[model samples]
Target: MTSALLEQSVVETPSSFRVLTGDRPTGRLHLGHYFGTLHNRIRLQRLGVEVMLIIADYQVLTDRDLAERLPEHVEDLVLDYLAAGFDPGRGTVFAHSAVPALNQLLLPFLSLVSTAELSRNPTVKDEIAHSRQAAVSGLMFTYPAHQAADILFCKANLVPVGQDQLPHLELTRTIARRFNDRYGKVFPEPAPMLSAAPLLLGTDGTKMSKSRGNAISLSATADETARLIKGAKTDVERHITYEPQRRPEVSSLVLLASLCQDRDPHEVAEEIGSGGAAALKRTVTSAVNEFLAPIRARRTELARDRRYLRQVLRVGNARANEIADSTLAEVRRAMRTVY
Candidate 1:
C-alpha cells in the first residue's frame, strides 16, 4: 500500500502535500510505536514529504490533572524521533504550548463538529472510560476537535495514523469540509496514510503500552530489553509456527525477531523451529539489541546536549507558528472576521 502511495504522482510531488502526525508526551514510546509509526515517518521524510510533528503537551492534561515532568517528556519524544532516523533538517517537531496560533485554531474548529459526534468517537469514549479521574474534563470530551486543530492548523492534507486514530482523522476531514462549505476553502480534507508495517504485539502478547508496564521503550538499555524479552509470555509450543491466531505469544517474539532482522515472520519462525520459547527469546534479544545499538548510541549522544534539543524545539515551534499564523489569517478572511 505504501509503495503504491509513494509511487503516486501526488506523493512524488512532495511540495504539494504536507503530513501532520504527533504523540502525546505522556510516556516513552515503545516497540509498538516503532513498527506502527516512527519507521513510517522516517520513510516518508526520506521521500521528500514535508512533515510536522506535535508534541501534544496540552492534550496530556485532558485525562490527567497534571503533566508531571512535562519538559523532560517533551524532550524525550524529540529524542526518540531523532534516534529513529527522523531528519530534523527536513521535518518539524513542535510543542503544543509553544505554538499559540495552533491552539487558537482550536476554537473555530470546535464549532464545526457536533457534540453527538464527539461523544460517539470510539477513541474518545475509550479514553474517557479509562481515565484515572472519576470526573472528566471538557477538554477530554472535545479531544477530536483539538486533534482537528492540530492537523488543520498547518493546512496539512495528509496524516500518518494507525487504524485506531482513523476516527479522529475522519472527524478532522468532516470539520475541514464543513468549514470550507460554511465559510471558504481554508483547509484540505486530510487523508490517512496508514502504516504498511504490521501491528506489533507487546512482549506479553497483549496490546503494548507504557502505562501497562508491558512496553519495551526505545530508550531501554540492552540489558533492560533482554530482561523484558526474557519475561515475555509464551505457551508450550516447541515447534514454533508463525500462526498468529494460534500462537500469538510465541509468534510475537518471533515477529519481534523477524522485524529486528528485517526478514519474514514465517521465515524466521521456520528457522527457529523446535527452539521453543527460550531459544525464540534469545533470537529476539540478539536481534533487538543489535538493531537498536546504533539508535541507542545516537540517543546517548543527542541526550547529552540539552541545549541542542532546546534549539530543535525552538526551530520547530517557530515553523509551526509561521504556518499556523498564515492559516489563521486565511480562516479569518474566510469568516470575514478581520476588522
Candidate 2:
C-alpha cells in the first residue's frame, strides 16, 4: 500500500476543519499583499472556515531585534489587516505574544523533534543564509516546531501558504506525525492551501519587500504613490511593450497598473503604445491611488479606534487560548502528564 493509505490507518482524524494563516507584524501591507493573500482571506472567510490570523510578532525576532518599534509596528500591522478586509467578526486575528498557551506548546513540541531535521529545513537554511547572522539563535533554529505549535494549538487543518513556504509546512506536518506517533494523535496534519499568486516583484524588479524599499505600502498617500511611480524605472526604448523577459522594467509598471486596475497588462500596453514611459507611469500611479483610496480612508477611520483593535485582539486571544488550552489538555492526557 502507498504511504498515504498506510499512514491513514494509524492516525485518527478530527471532525472540525479550520485554517491558520498570518504575517509578521514588522510593517504594513502592500499590493503584493492584495494579490497574494488579503483577497484570498476574504473569500476563505466567506466559505465558513474557522480562520485565525496570527500576528506573528514573536516570530519577527527570529531575524531582527524589534524591541523598540514593535508596538508601533504591531498597531500599524493591525490597521493594515483591518483595512485589507480581514473582519474580526468573521474570524480571530491575534498577536503571537498575546497567546501564551500557543507559545507554551513549543516547550513540549521541541522534545518531540530533532536538531538534525530542523537543520535540513530549506526555509530555515535559506533564512539563515539571508539574515547572514553567524550561528543562528536557538529560537530561530527551532522556528518550525514553534510554527507547529501555532497550528496544533488551534488544531488547524489548513494552512494557506505560498509555495516557498511549503517546506516549513512539511516540517509542521512532520512534527504533528511525530507527536501522534510518540504521544497520541492530538494534532492534525495541517495541509497547505497554496496561495493563488505565487510571486509578485517590486517596482525595482526584485521581490516586493519592506527592506528592499520597493514596496508601495497600503497606507501610502496619493502623493507618495505618484512620486514612487514617477521614480519607477521603465524601458529606454521609447515604446511600451508587453515582453517581461525582454523589457522587465516597463513590463513591471504595466503589471502593477494591471493588478491595481484589474485589467490585463498586455491590453494596457496596447492602449499606451508609442505613448511612452511618462504616460504609463501616470496611468499606473492614478490607478494605484484609486484602488487604495477606500482602503486608506477605512484605515484612517480605524486608526482613530485603537480601542476597537485592542478589543478585537483581546477577544481573538481568548478564543485562541480556549482552543489551545483544550488541545494542550488533550495532549497532556495522551502523554500521561496529568495524574
Candidate 3:
C-alpha cells in the first residue's frame, strides 16, 4: 500500500502543493546533498509544485560565533542551485535573513512551542552533541520554532525532508495546530514529502558532512574529487562487497558508484569484487568525476556572471517578501493583533 505522503504527492493539485526546502549556507554542497535533497527539489519544481528554496543564513549563527564569510557561502550556494537545475522562473530562492516577515512570525511561534518541548527534540539534542558546545544558545534551543516560521510564512503545505527531519516537521505540524486552535485557522499543517533517494555516505563511511571533511563537494574540480576519493578509507578486505554492516567504507564507494551510474550498489560491488579495493576506488573516482564534470563547469560559468546571480536572488527575495507579508497579515488578523 502507498503511504499517505506518497499518495499526497500524486493526488494534490499543483497549485495547492506548495513545497519548501533549503540548505544552510555553511559550505559548498556535496554529492550526498545532491542525491539526498537537491535532486528531489529539482523533481518537485519540474512537477509544477510551488517550490521555495531558502538559504538558511541566520540558522548558521546558532552555533557559529560570526558570519564573516556568510556572503561568500550564500553566493556559492546559489551557484550550486543553478547548476543543479533549480530554475528561478519555476521556484523562489531567497535567503532567510532577507525576509523580515519570517523573523517577525517567529515571535508568536515561540509561544506555541515550550522550552521543554524544544529541549526534547532529538534533532536538537543530536546537533548540540555534535557541536560540543560549552553552553548552548537560546537561539539553538529555539531553532525548530524558527523553522516552523519559515514553513508557515510561505504557507507551504508540503516540505520535502529526509527521514532524519521527521521530528522537525512534526513540531511544525504541532505548532500550526496549536496556533489555529488558539487564534484561528491561518496555516496548513505541512506534510512531509519524504525522499525516496538512497542516502550517500561520506568517503570515510560515516555520515556525509562538511564539518567531517569527508564529503566530495559539488563544486570540486575533477582532480580534487579524484584526490578525495583516492584517499578515502576502506577496509583490509581485498575483494569488494556490499556488506554495509561489516564493510561500510567499501560499501559507501559502491553506493556512490550506484548513484552515479544509476545501477544497483550490490551489482556494482560484485562487478568490481575481483579487482579488490583498488579497483573499486578507481571505479568510484571515475564515476564521481564524470558525474560532476558538467555540474562543476556550469557552476564555474555561473560564478563569472555575478550580476545575473544577484538579480536571481533579488527577484526571488522580492516575491518571497510579498508572499510572506500576505501570510503575516492574515496571521496578525487571526490573532487580533492588527493594530
Candidate 4:
C-alpha cells in the first residue's frame, strides 16, 4: 500500500508521537500479522518514533478457560515477532503481566471509567460471542479498562488500531480525559493511527482466528503453507473477477495475493485471465510461499537457540518496567496515592 493511499484513507497528524500496540499471545501469529500490523510497526520504529509492544497475556483470560500455557504462548509469540523483524532493542516488547505497575494503574483508572462505558465497547461484545461462559468472568467484562491501563500505564501518546478496535481506543481516551479531569493532566490522550491493512480472513473466509482453524501460523513449514492455500475455497465459476460482493471467495484470494506480493490484486487477476480458479489458486499459493520463505527460515534458525529468545524477553521486560514505573509514579501523585 502506498503512503498516498494510507494518507487518503486516514487523515495525517503531526509526527513525533509515542506509539503503543500489541496482541494477546494466545498462539503463534499468522499471515494476518504481516499484513495487519507487524510490517507497519517495524516501519514506525525505524522512523524514530518511540514504540511499545504489549504482549497482552492477561487479556487472554477473558476467553480462555485455562491459563496454564501462558508462558509458552508468550515465548512463541516473541520468537515469531523476532523472526518477522521486530527489533526488541529499538523498542520495548513485554508481557502485560511482566509489569506489575500496569495492573496497579487499573485501580485508579477504573474509578474514572464507568460500567456503562465498558459495556458499550464492541470488542467486549464481539469476544463474548466466542466464549462459552460469555456471561461470566469479571476479567472479561473489565478487559477494556485493563487495555486502557495497558496504554495509559506506559503513557503512550499514540495507538495504531483497526476500525474494529476504535471503540476500545475510544474507551482508553475516555479514561485519560476523566482521570485528568478528576485528578490532573498526567496522561496524554492517545490518538488512533488507523491501519491501512484490511481485515485478512482465514482460508474458510471467516475471520482468521486460532479457534476457527482458518489461520496460517507464521512458523508453519512451506509444505504446510502450500497445503493450506491449495485447499482454500474459491468460487465455482472458472473465470476470475475482483468483485468481492459477487465473488467473495475469489476476491479474498486476490486480497491475500495482493498482500503477499505487494502488487495490485486486480492486476494479478487480469494476468491470470480466464485460466480459471485453479490457476488463480496456484498463483496465490506460489506467491504466498515465496513471501513466507525467508520468515520460515528465520523462525527455524531462531527456534534452535531458545536461550537467546529468553534473554530477549528478559531484557525487554526490564526496559518496559522502567517506562511503566515512571508513568505509574506520576499517576499515583496525580491521584494523591503517594506516600
Candidate 5:
C-alpha cells in the first residue's frame, strides 16, 4: 500500500484495521525493537486498531533447538511489551503455539507458495547463513508460509515490520492474492507500516541484538545502561557530527541520543561540538537512562505479578483462537472442505 493510503486508513478507519505484530521469545527486546516497531504498535492500538501480538515460541525452534528456559523468555517478552505501554486490554497478545487453528492455516498457505520462492526470501537466506545449519530444518525452510498463517489467520490487514522484513510480508500478500484467485477471497493483503526511525545500530558498530551482547535491553538497570553506552562505538574525531553515511559509528551514537532526547540528530551533535565521543557517550547514557527509567520501573513492578501476566496471555489466547477459528472456517468453506 502507498504511504498516503496507509495514513488515510490510520486516521479515517483505524477501527477497521487489524495489526499483526510480535517478537520472538529467543531473547529480550531492545532499543531496536522499541523504535523499530513497538512504538508504532502502541500508537495504533491506542488509536483503536486491533493489534494481535504473537510471542512466536515456535519460530524460536526454526533456528535453535529451543530457547533456554523458554517460558521465562516468553514472559520477559510480554513484560517488555507491557512496560512499553502495549495494552493487552485493548489488543490481543498470545503465544503462537496456543492457537492451533492459526498453525493449521500454514498447510493451505504453504501450497500457495513454492520452495524456490521461500529459498529466495532474503530474510530466510540471512537466517540460514547465520544458523550454521548443515541441512535446513523443514520449519526453517517454510517459515515464510508459517508467518503468512500468523498474519492471515487473523485476517490482519496491517503488519508493522522493519524494511528488511518486507519480503516476508510480500510473500504473505502473494499467498493472500493467490488464495483469493484459486480458492476464494479468504484473506486481506496486509500492508507494511514501516518504522520511520532509521535502524538503530548496536554498541559495537553492528546490528543491535541481544545475542550479540551489543544491545541495551528494556529491562536493563541504570548502571547497566550506563556501562553499555560507555562501550558504544565512536570515532576519534573531536568534533561531533551526524553525517550517517560518512561517520556511521559516531553518527549512530548521536542518533541514539537524539532518539532518546526526541531532538534532531544534527542538533544533538551541535550541542556536543568538540566534546567528542566521550561527551557523546555520557549524553547518550543520561538520555537513555532518563527515558527508560519509568519503563524499567513499570517492568519491575509488573514482573512481581506472574499471575497477572499469565491471565493476560490466557485472555489473549482465547480471543486469538476465536478469530483464528472463524478465519479457518471461512477458509474451509471457500475451499469446499466444510464437509
Candidate 6:
C-alpha cells in the first residue's frame, strides 16, 4: 500500500486533527521505531495533520543517572527525524526542556491525579521493571503525570501509539476529563492513533530494545547492519516460513523483511523458503541494508550541517513555546489563576 493509503487506513480523523508524538532522547532510533511509529508520523504529516514531534529530554531523567550525555542524544534524535522524512516546516519538532510551560502545567496536573491512580499505571510499572531500578524515584513514579502534561500542554487531540502505550493514553484521557470536570474544559481528551504496522522484534527474537543490544539502530552503518542480521538467531527449520508461535526467531526475520519490502510476511517467507536459513539471512540482510541506505546517506549529509540542525531545534522550540503559552493561558483562566 502507498504511504497515504497506509496512513488513511490507520488514522481516522478530521483534516484539522492535531497530533502529538515523541521519543525520549536516550539513544538513536532503530528499525523497530521506524516501522512502529516513525513511518506513521511522517505519513500523518504528509496528510496535512498538525503534528508536533517532541524530544522528551526530561522524561529520560526518570531512569538515566546522568544528564551529561543528553545533548548528544538529542542532536542525534533530530538527525534521525530529518533523515526519516519528518519536515520541521510541516510539523513542529521541539525539545521538552525548552518549553517551560509544560513543566508549569505539570504541577497542577499532579493534583488532578491521585497517588493510588499513579501507582496503578501499568506502563509505569513495566518501565520501572525494564529499567531494573531498585526503587522507583518520585520523578519516575510520576512519569505518567509528566506524559499527561505533555499531551495536554499542546491540547493535542490525537497521540499516535502502539498497543503497549494504550494505558498511557488512557491516563492522559483520565487526567483531561478530571481537570475539565474539576476546573473547566481546558484540554482535549487525546485519543490513541494506533498503528496498523506489526511490531518488529529485536534480532535476538525478543522485544526490540537499545539497552538489550538486540535493536538495529537506524544510524548503524551498512556493514554493521549486515553483520547484525547475519548474527541474528533463526530457527533450525530447513524451510523458511512465518510461524510466530512455533518459530518466533524465523518469524521475526520474515516480519523484518516484510516491513522493509512492504509486503506480507508470508510472501517474504515463501520467497526465501527455498534457500533455508542461510538464504533467509542473506535476503534479510540485503533488504534491510537497501532500505536504510538512503536514510543513512541523508543522515550523514545532515550531520555535517550542525548549524542547520541547531536552527531547526531553535525554530521548533519557539513555535512550541508560542502554542504552549496560549494553551497555558487558557488553562490558567479556567482555574481562576489568570493573575
Model 5 residue pairs with clashes = none
Q: What tens digits encode model 3's per-residue C-alpha lDDT throughout 1-339?
A: 235756465456666688888999999999989998898888778878878999999999888767658888888889999998899998999999999998999999999988899999988898788764578888889999999998989989888877889999999999999999999898999988777767677877778998899999999888898888888889888989898888888888898999999999999998997798889989999998888888888898999998888888999999999998999899889989877
Q: For candidate 5, lDDT tens digit of each residue in 126-223? A: 99998845677999999999999999899899988767889999999999999999997778899888767677899999989888999999988999
Q: Write the per-residue lDDT of candidate 4 for residues 1-339, one digit (tens) a residue.
A: 344554443334425567888889878899887788998888777776777888998888888777757888898988888888888888878888889988998888778777888787898887787686636599988999999999988788778888898899988999899889898898888878778786677888877877788888888877888888888888778878787878887888888888889898889888887999788888888888888889889999999998888898888799889988998888878778888
Error of 3 at 148 (Å): 0.2
Model 1, global lDDT: 0.88
Model 3 lDDT, residue 316, Cα: 92
Window of ten residues with lowest summed lDDT in model 1 = 1-10
Ranking by TM-score: 5, 1, 3, 6, 4, 2
So what's the TM-score on candidate 3?
A: 0.96
Q: Cα miss at 146, model 5 (Å)?
A: 0.4
lDDT of 1 at 32: 86
| Candidate 6 Cα errors over 4 Å, as ranges | 1-14
**lDDT string, candidate 6, 1-339, tens digits:** 444653564466546578898999988999999988998889888878888999999988787666658889899999999999999998889999999998898888899888988888998787788774566778888899999988889889888877888888898899999999999778888767767767677888888998789999999998898889888888767999999889989999888888888889999998887799889888888889999999999999999998888899999999999999998898889889976
Q: By lDDT, rank the candidates, best first.
A: 5, 3, 1, 6, 4, 2
Q: What lDDT tens digits, residue by residue, belong to model 2 across residues 125-204?
A: 88888874556787789889988888889888877788889888988888889989998788889877766573567877
Question: lDDT of all the models against the reference?
Answer: 0.88, 0.82, 0.88, 0.83, 0.90, 0.87
Pick out the ten consecutive residues of candidate 4 with the lowest summed lDDT.
Answer: 5-14
Q: Highest TM-score: give the candidate number.
A: 5
lDDT for position 144 in model 3: 95
